[model samples]
Target: MRKSNLIFIFLMLIIATSCDNEEAVSEQSSTEFSSMQDGLITLKSGAIVEKKGDDFYYQSDMLLSQKQLETLNEHGDFIIEEPDQIENETEIHPVYNIPVEANEDGPAVPRAFGLYPTPYNMWAMVRFVYAPNLTADRKNIIQQALQHWEANTNVRFYNATGQPTVDPVYGFEYPYIEFVNATGNSSAVGRIGGRQKIRIAAWQATSVAIHEIGHAIGLRHEQSRYDRDNSININLSNVHPDNRHNFNKYTSNYFAVGSIDYNSVMMYDSDAFAINPAIPVMTKKSDGSTWNGGNVLSNPDRSWANNIYIPYIARSDTYRELAPVVYKPDNTVMTPSERLALQAQLNNGNPNPPNCCRLPNNF
Candidate 1:
C-alpha cells in the first residue's frame, strides 16, 4: 500500500510584504504556490518548521514567535492515547497540556496545545488594537469577525485602539492582539505573550479574520487532527510539493476535541494547495465527497471555546468580574439565576462582588 498522508509535520513559512494601501488587492490566483520558496528549521522537539523572511511558521499560516518555539522545545509529552474515536453527540473536546513550570501563576492547567494559560499567558479579556495604518475595509472586516466570536462563544474582545500598551496606573504591560494589514493572512497560535499580530490581507473576507482569531485563541486546524485519516483522505500527489506539508497531521502530542468536524472554521477546503485548481486535495473518506472550509464557528467550534475561556469584564482591578453573558459548555446562555449563582461561585459566594474599577463600556 502506498504510504498514507498520515505524516507528522510542523512550521512551513511563506514570505510576503505588508501593504498599507487602502485599496483591497485582488485575491491570489489558485496557482499562488507556483512561485514560492521556503526555508526550513528543526526545533528541539524534532518538529521541523519553515523560516521565511523574519518570521517562522507552523503549517504555513500560523506565525510562530520565539517564545512559542521555546515552549515547544521544552515539552514533548502526551497525556492521551491516539484518538481513533469518531465524532458522536457526546464527543469530548481533546486539548493539549504541558507540565507546568514553577511560576507566580499556578502550574499550567490542561489547555489546548499552544493555548495561552491562565493568570499569565491567558487573557483576562482578550484585548485588541487596530493597526493605525489598517485600511477602513480591513478594520471593518476585523470588527465583523470580532462580533461573530462574541456572539457565539464566551470569548470577549476589548477595543484598545489609541490606548496605551501599558496600564498607565499599574505600570504593567498588557497582552493584546493588533490587527494589521499584510499581503497574506496569518496569526500566532494562541497568545505568544505581550503583543501579537493577526495579519489580514486586503482581499481576504471576514471569514479569514474569524479563522485567524480562532488561532489567536488557541485552536488548530481541524483537519490536522492525528486520527483524521478515518474521516478524510489526502491526495498527496495532487498537492503542491511545497504545500504538501500543510496537510501533515498532528502527532500524539496534539489532541483532538471531537471527531473531525467538516464544519470547523479551522479546516482547510477540498482544493487547498491543490496542484490542479479543479481537483480536490481532500475528500471525505466515507463517501468521497468534497466539503468547503467553514466560514463561521460550528457547534463543536463553539463548544471548544466555551470549554476553555471564561468571559470577563476587562479591567485593571484586583477583583475579576464575570461578564453578564456567559455561555454554558453546551453553547447555551445560562439563565439569569444560573448566571448569578455561577458568579457567586466564582467570587467566593458573593454574587455581586465589588469591582475595583468601572467596567469598560465596550463590553
Candidate 2:
C-alpha cells in the first residue's frame, strides 16, 4: 500500500459521488397552493421542500407550463433541488456510496489463514493546520492524541524532516509512523504502505486528525444508522437543517448492528451550524461497562481493535473467525483460509505458523 494508493483509497471513500433519479414535484395554480409561512414544506416521505408556490414543477416526465419550462432553462435544463428536500423541509439525509469493486482474482482468502500482519517499523507522519488565531496550546492537543494512541496501541510516531510528498510507499517496514502538513479543503487520514498521513483543515480542531488515524488502522464508523434496532430516534419532521444531508446517508455499511456511539472520537459533532441530533449518545455496554468520557479510547474500541488487529495482520485461525466477510464487488463474500494464508505471507515478515499448525503454507 503506497502512500499514493492509500490517498486514492481515502479519496474514493470520502469524495466519491453517484447519480440518482430526482423525484419530480407536481405543480398547481397559485390559488391551489398556499404560500408556506415557514418558508418550507414537508412531504409525506419526510423530505423538505422550499415552497415556490406556482413557481415551477415537473409534469408528465417533462417541464409542463411555460413558466416551469423557463425556470428549467434558467437552471441549465436539470432538476435543481432534490425531491426529498421538497417532501421533507426539515432535514434531507445525505447518501454516501461505498465503492464495491470486483476482485479480478478469485474469492478473497478466509480469515482463518489469509490475514496479513500489520507493517511494523513504519512511521506515521502527522500534520495539523490550525486557525490563524488558534492558541499555541491547541497544537499540543494533537500530540496528546498521538500519545494517547501510542500508549494504548503500542505504536510509535515519528516527525518528518522536509515537505511531505504524496509518495506511494511507506516506511522501510512497519511499526513506525510519520506526520506531515497537507494543503487542501479536505480533512482526512490515510495510510501509505507503512506510513500514515493526515490532512487537517486550518480552521478545524486537532481531534479530527486523531479520529482519522483510527480510520487508518482499519476502524469503521461507530455510528452506523442502518440497523433499525440501534436505538436511534430521529424526528423526521424537525431535523436540523445542517445535518439533513448526512442523516439521510447513514446506513448499515457505515454503522454497526445494535449500537450507535455518539461519543466515538470518529464521529462528526457539527456540520455548519445545526448540531446533528441523529448522532447517538454513548451508553454503557449492555453489560454495564463504562468508558472515560474524554480524549481516551473506550473499552469497546480497544477490545474491538484487540480482537481484529492481530488477525488483520497475522491471519491466525482465531483472527479469521472474527472477520468472516472480505467485502468485494458484486457481493459480501466469505474469505478462504488459503487466501488468508497468502495475505499473511505478504504482510507478516514470517508467515510460517508456530509448530502447532505446521500444515502446508504454515500460516
Candidate 3:
C-alpha cells in the first residue's frame, strides 16, 4: 500500500481506538409542543412542513423545502469526479415558510436547520453511528469531518453505539446520523425525525463528508442563493443542458441573508457544472475569479450559522411578526397602518404611492 494510505489507516485506527469507550449521550427534545399535525404546504421533493408555535417543521421536525426556501434559502453533493455534483442533483434540503402567525424574533432572525444551532436551545446535539459495512478509514474520515463542524459552531454530534430507534431521554429527537453505502456523498438537511443517512463514497470521503454535514446543519449552496447573480456569473451557455436548472435563483420564497458569499462551504466550485472540462460554469465578477469553494468554513459560513441558530425563543401564544420574509403585492408587512393603507389601495387603487402598493404591470 502507498505510504499515504498507511498513514491514513494509522490515523483511522487511532480514532476508532479512542472511540472504543465513547459513550452515547441519551436525550430527547427540551421544548414542549402540541402533538405533530399536518402542514399546509407540500414541497417539490414531497417533504411536508408545518408550523408548531413559532417554528416550522417536517412532521415533528422543522424542515423547509429547498425550492420554496429560495426566498429565504438561496443555499449538497455527489459524484467525486463527475461535474454534476450539486445539491439539486444529489440531495434536496427543505425550508419552511414564515409562520402564518410569526415569532417575536420574527421569522428571519434565527432558526433554519438542525445543525450546530437548533431551536430547542442554542446547540443541536447530533447522535450518530456507523453502518456495519463502513470501514475504519471511512469512519475516521466521517468523524473528523464532523469535528470540523463541532470546532466551528455551537452544535455538537455524538457517535452512537447503535442506531437510535427511540429518542434520547436527555438529547433531541432521533438526532442520529447513520453512515451507509452510496454512490456519492449526500445527507438530508436538518433532522428528519429518525435515522438520517449520510451516504459517503469511500474514495473521497473526508471533504465530501464535511460538505454533506454542512447541508445536514441547514445551509444551502452559496451559488443557489437569491443574490448569487450579483457576485458570480453562471455560464449557463457552457453548462450541460441536464444540469442547467441548478443555476435557477429563488422564485418561490425567500431573500438572501445580506450579500452573496462566494467562499461559502455551501457554494460550488467553478468547474463543478461545466459542459466540457475546460469550460468553467461559474465565474466571479470582482476580479473575474472562479469560485473554488472553501475547504473549511469561511467567515460567512460561520456568521450565517451564528445568525440562523443564535438563541432559541419558544413560540408564544400571541405571535409577533418581526420582519416579513415574503411580502404581499402591496409591499406591506404586519404594521397596522400599512395594512389600512393596503386595504384602501386594493379596494379602489386609491392614494397609492409610487413605491408602495404598486403591483407589476402584468398584475
Candidate 4:
C-alpha cells in the first residue's frame, strides 16, 4: 500500500472537545482513566486506539479521527524510512492548502504513514491562537516556548490571536491551532484538521508547553522509536498496566531520524508511567541507570523540524511564489536574492505564480 504522510511517535492525551464547546476535559490520572469505562478500538489493519467518551486516542495524547481510523482499516503495511527518504516519489513540495490523497494509518511522527499527509495537515507555517479563557500566565508560558522553537528551528508560529478563524474572501475555513487551558497537558500528534488544541494545565512549566507544541508540529516521544530497545530497556514490570502502552515500542512502520536522543524534549523520563514513583521504569541499555529527559530541543529535534518545514509569511493574495523573506530551518532568514533563486527553481522562473496561497488572518 502507498505510505501516508510522514512523522511522529506518541505521547500525551487530549479530552474530546465538542464542536461548539471548548471546555477542558477534567484532569484524571491516566492510570485511573485507563481503569474507567473505556473501549478498545481495534482496526482491521491491527492498529489499536482507545475510545473514551467521544474521542479516539493513540498512545497517550495523539488524537485519532474516525476518517484516519477508517484509512487504517483499509491499509496496513508501513515502512520506516530515513529522514532523507521522506521526499520520495510520492512526496510533494510542502505547500499550503494543497490536497494530498493518501492513507493515514500507522504510528505517530517521524517518516511514517501515520501523519495526516494533506498539505493542510503538514503545517507549512504553524498558525496558532490563544483561547479567550486562557490565563495570562499560560499565554506567557506558551510565548516563551514559541520563542524557543523560533530560536532553534525553522518552525515559525504566527500568533492569530483576535483573528477570524475563516477567510473572509474565499470563505474557506483555515486550519489553525488553539491553545486552551486544561486539567492535564495533551495535544493531537500532528495537525488533525481544523482547530486542534494544545491543552495546558496551570501547573505545567514552559518546557511542557514546548513539548506539547512539538507534538502539535509533528514530533513524537523519543522513546517510541522502534529501535529504542537498543538504547533503553523498559521495565514493564514496574509500570502500571494501563499506562504500559505509553512505553510500548513503535513498530518498523514508524520512521526515525538519527540515533535515540536521551536529551530530546520529546523523550519520557526513566520513571515515566512508573507504578512506584521512586522506582525506575526505564534505564539506558549501556549503563542500566535511569535518566531525566531534557527540557530543551536537542540537535536531532532541530534537524527534524528543519528538514520538514519551511517558514512562510501568511498573505491574503493568491501569490504562490515563495515569499521574498523566508526563514530557513536553521533559524536563519533567507535573503531576497536567495528566495528568488529558490523560487526560480520551484516555478521554472514562471512570471505567473500559482494562485492558491495561505490566506492572511485565516485561522
Q: Pairing residues by index, what is the TM-score of model 4?
A: 0.69
Candidate 4 global lDDT: 0.61
lDDT of 3 at 206: 66
The C-alpha local distance difference test score for the whole of candidate 2 amounts to: 0.33
Candidate numbers sorted by lDDT from highest down: 1, 4, 3, 2
Which lDDT tens digits does candidate 4 get at residues 1-363?
Answer: 112211110000011111222223334533333453566655577666677775666677766544444444445322122223343222332221122332332222223223323333456567799999998878889989998987777677777888888879876556678999977787776665667788898967888999889888877778877667877888899986667767655553333533577888888899998888888988999988888877888765775575465544555553435544455433356777766655554334553565666665422
Between candidates 3 and 4, the one scoring higher on TM-score is 4
Candidate 3: minimum summed lDDT over ten consecutive residues — where?
73-82
- Candidate 1 lDDT tens digits, 272-333: 98889688989999999999978998876786777566676766554446778888655778
Worst 10 residues of 4 by lDDT: 8-17
**How does candidate 1 fare on TM-score?**
0.75
Question: Per-prediction TM-score, please?
Answer: 0.75, 0.36, 0.52, 0.69
Report the lDDT of model 3 for residue 122. 19
Index of the highest-TM-score prediction: 1
RMSD (CA, Å), each prediction: 12.6, 17.0, 21.4, 10.0
Clash totals, every prediction = 3, 51, 22, 11
Backbone clashes in candidate 1 total 3
